[model samples]
Target chain A: MFDWLFRYANPARFMGLSGALLPWLWSAALLTLATALYLGFSAPPDYQQGRTVLILFIHVPAAIMATNVYACMVVASLFSLINRHILADVAARTAAPLGAIFTLLALITGSLWGKPMWGTWWVWDGRLTSTLVQFFLYLGYIALWNAIEDETRAARICAVLALVGAVNIPIIKFSVDWWATLHQGESIMSGNLAGPFLVPFLVMMLFYMLLFVCLWLTRIRTLILERRLRSLMGAA
Target chain B: MNFDLSPYGAFIWPAYAVSALLLGGLTLWAMARWRAVKAKLATLEKT
Candidate 1:
């Protein structure tokens, strides 16, 4: 199984496989997003939050993916640092901007939801503060990657940054529980979400996850091709 | 569905609109960049 899996570790094989998978991943993303949107907007307003809760359909998943993608980057960075895998470096580098985008979306949407509900555009609550820190970590990771010209050196430095930054992930996760904050804790995990809201939320999560996977694969494939072209040019 | 949008409509509408614009814009930008990169690679491969 490991041998078969590692076969695609080669850039050419990975590109071929990803090329074949892209269309299907894209189709799944579109279909699920359509279904999620239909269910999200059509659902009845919450008894407490009214229509504002609809924002969670997008916000929650973006927030989840923001942290999860960062975690993935850290792991990929570790592989690049330890094993010196070029592919892992490419994966970590490509994922940073995407993760940052999701983190931004999460913060923007969360603030949008908060204004009406919390009566403020921004708050320095525990969850909010920790999430802000997470966003900064993403930005810092990207900046670190860009600051260095040597690919291997950049990957190693960024990997260290990513590892150090991993500490924020747990803080972000538990901030609500650890501190007195206006921001609410997990709705689904803690069973605070109702059946009516949960279905659409789950669907939206699936949609967003599919979208992330599709984007990640495409970005990694492009990076691989770029490196291949650069080496070919050098050889010529 | 029948709730009055007059009160919070300004805030809600713009939020949704901005999100849509950003997400759509980013999607287009990524795809365009991918295509451009692929074209460059193809040219290099040909040489």
Candidate 2:
């Protein structure tokens, strides 16, 4: 299984595979997101939060992708460190900004939802604070990658930073349960949200995950092409 | 369909508007960057 998987570790083979898949991936992501938005908007207003609950369709998915994207980077970074795969390092490096953008969306949308529901725009609660820290970790990782001039040095250093920052992923996941917080703790999994609300949430989650995969593949392909262009220029 | 978000419409509409802007903007930007990179690679290869 591992040997078969490593066959695509070659950049050219990875490019061919990703290129063939990009159109289908983008189409599926758009389709799911559209269906999710339609369902989310049409759902009845919550007894407590009213239409503001609609924000969950976007915010919750963004939050999920935000953390998951970081996890992806950590895995990619580990592959780069262990296997010395340049493409894996490129995958990790390209994903940081996208993850940061998702994290930013989560923060902003959560704040928007919070004001109407929780009666505040920001809270220093464990979940909220840890998520905020996760956002900074993405920024720091991207900055470290950009600051280092040597590709090998940057990959090694960034992989270490990615590994270190991964400690926050579990903290972010479990924060609401670990401490009493303004953020609601584990609603979908805990059976707190009704089916009416949960279905659309799940749909949006799937859409967002698909979107991350699509975007990550696009960025990786672009980075590979970028490296090819650079080497060509150097050779010329 | 109902434009009545009542007291929270102001918050809810803008929240979605921001989400749409961010997600859509990022998607377009990434695709565009990919296209540009591919084009540059083509030109370099030709040269």
Candidate 3:
């Protein structure tokens, strides 16, 4: 089983597989997102928070996926550093920008939501600070990769940075509990995800995951094609 | 739904507008990057 899995680790095979999966993932993402949007807008406003709670339909999923994607990058970086897998490095590199985008979305939307709820645009609380740090770490990782000319050298440096940044993930996760923050703690996972709200939230989460898969596959395929072109040019 | 939008609507509208702008901007950036990458690949192939 492991051997069969490892066989597709070849960049060429992975590219082919990604191409096959892309259409399906893209369609699924679109459909799920459409449904999520419909449900989000149609749902009755929260009795307490009213219309402002609608922001969570997008904010929560973006925040969750941002953290999850960074964790994925850390794992990929580890594999690249330990086993010297070019594909792992490629995965890490391609995922960073996408993750950063989602993180930025989360932060912006969170701030927007915070303004009406917390009456402030920004705060130096735990969840917000840790997420901000995660964003910077992403920028640093991308900068490291771009600054180094040699691909292998860049991968090594990025792998080190990714590992170091992994420490922040836990901090972000527990920030609401650990420190005084304007951000609310885990409402979805801690049994606070009750009836009507929970269903739409889960649907949105599914939509976001599908979106990530589609984007990840597309980016990785693009990277593989770029590499092939470079090698072909070098040969000529 | 008899509530006052006069006061909070200013904040609400801008918030939604910014969200639209940010998401739209990011989408365009990613699509542009993808196209650039594809074009480079095409040029190499032609050569």
Candidate 4:
């Protein structure tokens, strides 16, 4: 199982595989988004949240992707640190900005949802604050990559940071349940959401995952190309 | 299909709009970067 995966550690091979998979990933992302939108809009407004419930389609998915991408980066960082792989560092490096954007979207959408539901644009509750910390960690990760001019040194340092920051992911996940917070706990997985609401949420979640993979592949390809170009310039 | 968002329209539309703007903007930025790198790689390879 892992043998096939290890073979793609070669940059050229990884590039070719990603190139082949890109079209299918993009198509799935678009299809899932369209289905999510169709289902989300067609469902009747919630009795309590009203049309504001539609915001969940975007918010929930963004939140999930926010944490999910970080986990991906941590795994990549592990590969970079333990295996001493450049491509793994590139994978971790490229993922930071995208994860930050998703976290930002989650914060914004959550704020918007909160304004209507909780009558406040922002709150410093455990869940929201933990998520805000997650966003900052992403920024810090990206900044660490840029702040150092030495690529190898930066990769090592950033890999350590990524490992340390892995602690926040679990905190963000359980923050709602661990403390009394304005944010609601896991409604979808807990079977609290109605079928009409659940379907779109699930579809949107799929769309988010597909979208992240598509973007991550594209970003990693770009990084690889950039690295190749740099080496060529050095040779020239 | 339905434009009757009514009272919550103000909140809902802006939320989706912000999401679209952020996600779309990030997508465009990533694609632009990818294209730039690809073009640079092509030029280097040609040389």
Please give the DockQ score of every candidate, comma-separated.
Answer: 0.43, 0.74, 0.33, 0.83
Against the true structure, candidate 2 has what lDDT?
0.83
**CA lDDT, candidate 3, residue A20:** 86
Best candidate according to DockQ: 4
Every prediction's TM-score for the first chain? 0.90, 0.90, 0.90, 0.90
Tens digit of lDDT per residue, candidate 1, span A147-231?
8999989999999989888865676558644664434454311113466888888998998788788888878887777777788
Best first by DockQ, ranked: 4, 2, 1, 3
Residue A43's lDDT in candidate 2: 85
**Residue pairs in collision within model 3:** none
- Clashes in model 1: which pairs? none
How well does candidate 3 score on lDDT at residue A137?
81
Cα misplacement distance, residue A149 of candidate 2 (Å): 0.8
Error of 2 at A112 (Å): 0.6
- Candidate order by lDDT, highest to lowest? 4, 2, 1, 3
Candidate 2, residues A1-236, lDDT tens digits: the string is 46886899899899999989988998998899888888887888887777777888888888878888988999999998998898888999988998999999999988888887767888656656777878989989989999999997899899999998887567655764466444555432111347688998888899989988998899888888888888888988
Lowest lDDT block of 10, candidate 3 chain A: A184-193
Residue-wise C-alpha lDDT for candidate 4, range A1-236, written one tens digit per residue: 55776799899999999999999999999999999888889888877777777888888888878888999999999999988888898899989999999999999998888887777888656657778888999999998899999898899899999998896567655764466443555432111346679988999999989989998999999888888888889999
lDDT of 3 by residue, A108-226 (tens): 87787777767787865666777787888889989889999999889889989898889756765586446643455543211123567777788888987887777777777778777
Q: Assess the local accuracy of residue A149 in candidate 3 as a C-alpha lDDT between 0 and 100.
A: 98
* Model 3, docking class: acceptable
Better of 2 and 3 by TM-score: 2
Which ten contiguous residues of candidate 4 chain A have the minimum total lDDT? A184-193
Most lDDT-accurate candidate: 4
